[model samples]
Target chain A: MIKVQQEDFDVSAELAALAAGNHGIGGIVSFVGLVRDLVGPDNAEPALRAMTLEHYPAMTEKKLGDIEAQANARWPLEASLIIHRYGRLEPGAQIVLVACAAAHRQDAFDSCNFLMDWLKTEAPFWKLEETEAGEDWVDSRASDDAAAARWQAKPDRAAE
Target chain B: MKILYFAWLRQRIGVAAEEFDLPADVTTIDDLVGYLTAKGPGYAKGFAEPQVIRAAVNYEYVPFDHKLSNNDEVAFFPPVTGG
Candidate 1:
């Protein structure tokens, strides 16, 4: 499942829903992203503040679907879910959530990390952090692409 | 044609989205970028560092050689930085 919405979600409820299925799955891995109080590129702002998120409508869902499909292909996942929020948010507010279930801990952990890595690089979302200095849109970081590439490089090398 | 920009590219270009007519010979991402750079100073400035810009055709990440058609929606963004 993939979602992009303005409303906040219940983390416990989501985890329960994902875990309530058939008992074939033995492990579940989940991740939650939260808005930080400090602003600026590196959280260098003196006064902590809020954030606003923006995203493309059709593109966001399509990209997420692709990422989920990739994860399912790599692992025998019983279930998976990705939820990301849009609109204005404050410090400590949840920004995104990713959950994965598989037969082993390794698959679950890897898939959870993979989902986040791809989402960070490919998802069509932008953040505008407001601080004492004013509002500043965040810049793209090379680290995200590196994270995504780590998994992809193995296959690429094999093909080469 | 619909065009989208993200991350620092959006900030530098000063707009999130724009609509423009597809040029006749712009059959690839590289061609499209060249055409856009000629349109105005803002686009030229935004696309100045061509090597750093990443593109997607209809939400699928594409290389410069990727083919494009009039119906396609193209987006340009910088290297992603999310956790």
Candidate 2:
């Protein structure tokens, strides 16, 4: 499942739903990304007051669905979920969530990481960080591109 | 054809969306971008750095050489920063 919403979500509730009736699922891995207070040069001080997220309505959902589909094809997962929030969010607010359930721990863990790595680089959302200094559009990090690239170095499903 | 701009591009272009008849010569995304940049100051400024500007056709990301159709929805924006 994949969702893009303006409202916050309950992480625990989402996890419960993913593993609801899946008795075959023996392990689950999840990741939550939060809006941090730190910003500016060194990212050592608390400068960000809020972050306004913008996305193309239908396009956002389409891209997220594609990412989820790719993850499912690459892993032996019983279930997976992705929830991302938009609009003006304050510091420490939940920004995104990824959860995966599988019969083994490896698939759950690896797929969770894969989902997040692709989401960071491929999702069609933009962020404007509001701070005392001024609002600034966040830039795509090279590190993120690097992380996403590793997955492409090999075929879709290769035994690790 | 429909053209959409987002985030800073929308702010700079002063409009979110617009419709135009695709000229016969505008066969690809790069061609369409060149046409937009030649339209007016707003477009020129918004696409000042065309290399950094990204595009999508029918809601899917595409390369500059991606072919264009008469009724396609094309969007222009900066690199994605979402998680």
**Each candidate's DockQ score against the native complex?**
0.46, 0.89
Model 2 earns a TM-score of 0.95
Sorted into a CAPRI-style docking class, model 1 comes out as acceptable
Q: Write the per-residue lDDT of candidate 1 for residues A1-160, one digit (tens) a residue.
A: 9888899999999988888956988988999999877646775655647888877668788988999999998877899999999888988999999999988888899889989999998887878878788887778777777888998866522134
- Interface RMSDs of the predictions, in order, are 2.2, 0.7
Off by over 4 Å in 2: A39-46, A155-157
Error of 2 at A132 (Å): 0.8
Please provide TM-scores, in order, for all candidate models, with all chains considered together.
Answer: 0.86, 0.95
Instruction: Give me the chain B TM-score of candidate 2.
Output: 0.94
Rate residue A38 of model 1 by lDDT.
Answer: 65
lDDT score of residue A137 within candidate 2: 92
